[model samples]
Target: MEAKNPLILTVRLDERSQRFFNEMRIKYFPPERNLLDAHLTLFHQLPDTNETLEIVQNSKRGVFEMGVIKLINLGAGVAYKVDSQELESLRQDLKRAFADRLIPQDKHGFRAHITIQNKTTPEQARLLIAELSESFEPFTIIANGLDLWEYLGGPWKHRGYQSFNYLDK
Candidate 1:
């Protein structure tokens, strides 16, 4: 049987991008709730099983760049909007492969993003959105691999990681 703890899948960002987003998260997110480093979640729930691990580790995906298109006012938080056809294609491949196992959130529309702030007042969120928007410029971040994490109630535990079929630059 699948473990009760669910799995989360994310696109691994390059070190520089990871560091930059983590810094933003630490500066803006409520500390008590900031349990994870910055991440771009692709799937919120996957079965925690050896099969799942094998499937992920066996992936042949190659590294690619994704566009950081804009900043989103997440009502009570802020996030950087992401867009890339290559990323979308990857998600769709996984979606189809795990169609029967998907939760509603994962099964429905997937808008890729990396949240920088959360768990604050809506007013505070609006202010941040405004402040960040003033200097917002589109950028790109490299997607180098896939990370698997086991949900630990509020915090997450690293499960495994599979680098895409290319050496890191």
Candidate 2:
């Protein structure tokens, strides 16, 4: 049997939001298992191909409207749900482009979010969600680029980044 090649594609957020999410992950996520910085995943397991790379490289940058903050019940953990039409549209475009290559998870509707904690007890997740939700607020985040990474089991290795160039509208 061939070993599966796990690749992750994600949207690169603006500096401020990126830092905020990363900090949250650092503070809340299980230190032993928190191998990756916070990120908004677009495709969980994309195939490594030139076509995929081209699509990311040609993607345009846009301002994503970060909607209300809601807690996601991850069963074993929780996440901060981020609503963004612009980001969803981009993901849809990519989905269509790689329709045949998409995995089952990627075939479904894209739910943009930043997972601050995972692989923990449900009770712990609920406590953190409640604590965080009290002060949560909506904000805007810039989708400046697409990031690709090779998922080496638990730890992901950086593969490449395709920065989006915004066109004057």
Leading candidate by lDDT? 1
Q: How many clashing pairs in candidate 2?
A: 0
lDDT of 1 by residue, 1-70 (tens): 5547999999999999999999999999999999999999999999987878887886667889999999
Instruction: Give lDDT tens digits, candidate 2, residues 25-98.
Output: 99989999999999999999998777877877777664455663687878667788888777778888899888
- Candidate 1 segments whose C-alpha is farther than 4 A from its true place: 1-3, 166-169
TM-score of 2: 0.91
Score each candidate by Cα lDDT. 0.92, 0.83
Q: How far is candidate 1 from the true structure (C-alpha RMSD, Å)?
A: 2.3
Q: List the residue pairs that clash in candidate 1.
A: none
**lDDT score for residue 15 of model 1:** 98
Each prediction's TM-score against the native?
Answer: 0.94, 0.91
